[model samples]
Target: MLNRERYRGRLIDHIGLVVRDFAASKAFYTAVFKALNIPIGGSDERNLWADELFISTSDSDEVEGHLTGRIHLAFQAQDRAMVDAFYRAAMAQGGRDNGAPGERSYHPGYYAAFVLDPDGNNIEAVFRGASERSAAAVRIRY
Candidate 1:
């Protein structure tokens, strides 16, 4: 069994993505996550997981020979520079740029960048200006 710990965020429990090309998706996400300063919690040939995101090949039990539809996931970044790094790393790892990093009309200091993952999922890195969080994450062990 895979030894792992869970870090819960404010609103989401977890998200799973089933991909066709596991290796490509893994490489793409690994680089992108690294740029965002998130570590790979645990992984094997069939599974890759981080804090709240779980990715698997279609052959995995959770996938059962199925593929997930394109979905959008926005990750939090420390600052605009991190968002830029995410774009650069993702581009070097087969990610397509959906949107360049910039302030959005969503609100002031809403800096973010968008990229399409190997599976065409819209992935994003966003930095919402200066703010404070209650905690880094809620830790859970199993």
Candidate 2:
């Protein structure tokens, strides 16, 4: 399981991506995430994935009435190398590039790369440069 405490202060709690083609999207995400050392938390009904990014098909009950596949999702990279690897893996998996890896004026250490998934969603791998986080994570004893 992911350490939810690590995501504190983020505006969004979680996000879901409703894709058109399940198989392609799954393969693409799996490959890219593997390059980043993130695991595939879980899967649902062979048509959905319950990971950091909850991927579902348009036929899903919750998204049946909605049109999806248009959004920008950025994944955190441990370093610039990981961002580069993510771009390579994503492209090797048939993804299209939106931007190459580089530093951004968004902030002093903001580096990112962007790609378009098979379903047209913009996916990014970003390295926020060297900086200390406020907390290691929210900890608790179970």
Candidate 3:
């Protein structure tokens, strides 16, 4: 099994996106995050040392030379309610709904919501714990 502390310790400091238009991508991400109530981590126009960068390009430009593809990214949710809220917020911000908040059997009580960012990147908000039923039984909301 994975080391729980190590996994939890390596919190996602940031995420990088490569887009055709930096401004548009930034705007889209900003709006989506705002709606979800996630604070802006950081951004820059002169970031050259980053592994993933969102650079300005033309409409005809392709991601990594391909017309379209997906990059997976996820955010931590405080609880199941926050996951639901994030899903609604993302949809309100022009994100396409990919999945609704629910328990994932694969993860054994993993609750999450998913959406496609403006650049087609897969974004998710996840909460790990028992399902609402079980959680309620134990009075676990946080």
Candidate 4:
């Protein structure tokens, strides 16, 4: 997995996107995810999912209505090198270059890369640089 602990309660546990072409999207994600060291959690004819992201055909009933606009998704990178690898692999697998790998002014050490998926959604891989965390995650138990 891509270190789910950083999200905690700030981001939703999961999100789904309806892509114009499932095959292209699948290829693009698979290549880039390989660079980031995340696995394909599961998939079938209609959709694919990994960790917190879900992708399916635009005609699918659940996501058909939301396929018009682009979406932004950022994946965590363990280091700056992974961000660069993600950009290269993504572009090699039909992803369009949105932003090259570099440090962003979003914060002092926010290094990241961006690309446009087959559906034109903004996909990113980012590393916050070396830092320590008090805890890997904040889990809720009933």
Candidate 5:
């Protein structure tokens, strides 16, 4: 018999986003990361020597000048306090706040905060804990 209970999946490794101008996108992502106090892993800008490449000069051009199909990306936070800090920093760095740091009961103790990046991407920081629900309830009820 297999011991299914012993199986545990590790956290996510990394995420990728295609940008029109690598320099501009790098700067924007770097700013948000600095605000959140998350170290950037790495990035690169290389020309693809292939035929089926659809490279564009800018993100808007890549997406046909419309902010459609916005991408949502979330990062794991160490704790609720970290989530709060991330939200504050993001707002301070010109990120638009979508949701404040608090519990999302719909997700079972999910404490998260959301923000919009310079390019209108939805970014979030989240932590998992039961205390988050109680705190959220207090804020909501009061």
Candidate 6:
């Protein structure tokens, strides 16, 4: 067993973002994902991935030389403190603060922080307060 586990039934199976500069984007994302406690699943000169997100240089075959427009992507944080950590790490890695960590009216306990990635994509970390889960995720072994 490789001890692999993944949360299936997500809205998106995967998403690829083509960036103008892979090196810069890679550095920024590396720090950001670290704060989120997500591992860098794999990488090469052209692409790096963490979980469902794949980032690559525009020249990559999957990207087809097309750079994606600025988009908002929100990651789930386990708690409020993690959201703050995410903001701090992002800022340290050249991420611009779009919004500081705070609660919003989106729901009763929607705590979130936003930052613009190196490519100016809006990235957010949010904690939806305490909740229940049936299981951590679907486990797969290889």
Q: Tally clashes: model 5.
A: 0
The sequence of per-residue lDDT tens digits that candidate 4 reaches over residues 1-142 is 2233323454577789887788888889889889999878767766777766878886665456457478899998999999999999999998899999999999999999999999899999999989887775565443
Model 3, residue 50: C-alpha shift (Å): 13
State the lDDT of candidate 1 residue by residue for 42-138, as single tens digits: 8889999888788999788855757988899999999999999999999999999899989899998999999999999999999999998889888
Worst 10 residues of 6 by lDDT: 1-10
Give the lDDT of residue 102 in candidate 3.
90
TM-scores for all candidates: the values are 0.95, 0.80, 0.59, 0.83, 0.56, 0.91
lDDT of 6 by residue, 53-108 (tens): 88998888766858899989999999999999999999999999999999999999
Poorly placed runs, candidate 5 (over 4 Å): 1-14, 20-28, 34-37, 43-69, 130-142
Better of 3 and 5 by TM-score: 3
Question: If both were scored by lDDT, which would come out higher, candidate 2 or candidate 5?
Answer: 2
Model 2: weakest 10-residue lDDT segment is 1-10
lDDT string for model 5 (48-131, tens) is 111111222234332254333477888667678888888887777667889988989767879999988666779898887744
Candidate 5 vs. true structure, TM-score: 0.56
Q: Which RMSD values do the candidates have, in order? A: 1.2, 3.5, 10.0, 4.2, 12.9, 2.7
Residue pairs clashing, model 2: none
List the global CA lDDT of all models: 0.91, 0.77, 0.58, 0.83, 0.56, 0.87
Q: TM-score ranking from best to worst?
A: 1, 6, 4, 2, 3, 5
State model 3's lDDT: 0.58
Model 3, range 1-142, lDDT digits (tens) per residue?
1111111123343344556555656665666566455555345562211112233333423224433358877766668888898788777666788888898776676899888877878888898874343231121122
Model 1: clashing residue pairs?
none
Candidate 6 error regions (>4 Å)? 1-7, 140-142
Task: For residues 1-142, write the lDDT of model 2, one tens digit per residue.
Answer: 3333323354565577777778888889988988877767565654444333677777776445354748998888899999999999999998999998899899898989999999888999999988787874443433
- The number of the candidate with the highest lDDT is 1
Range of the 10 consecutive residues with the lowest summed lDDT in candidate 4: 1-10
Top-TM-score candidate index = 1
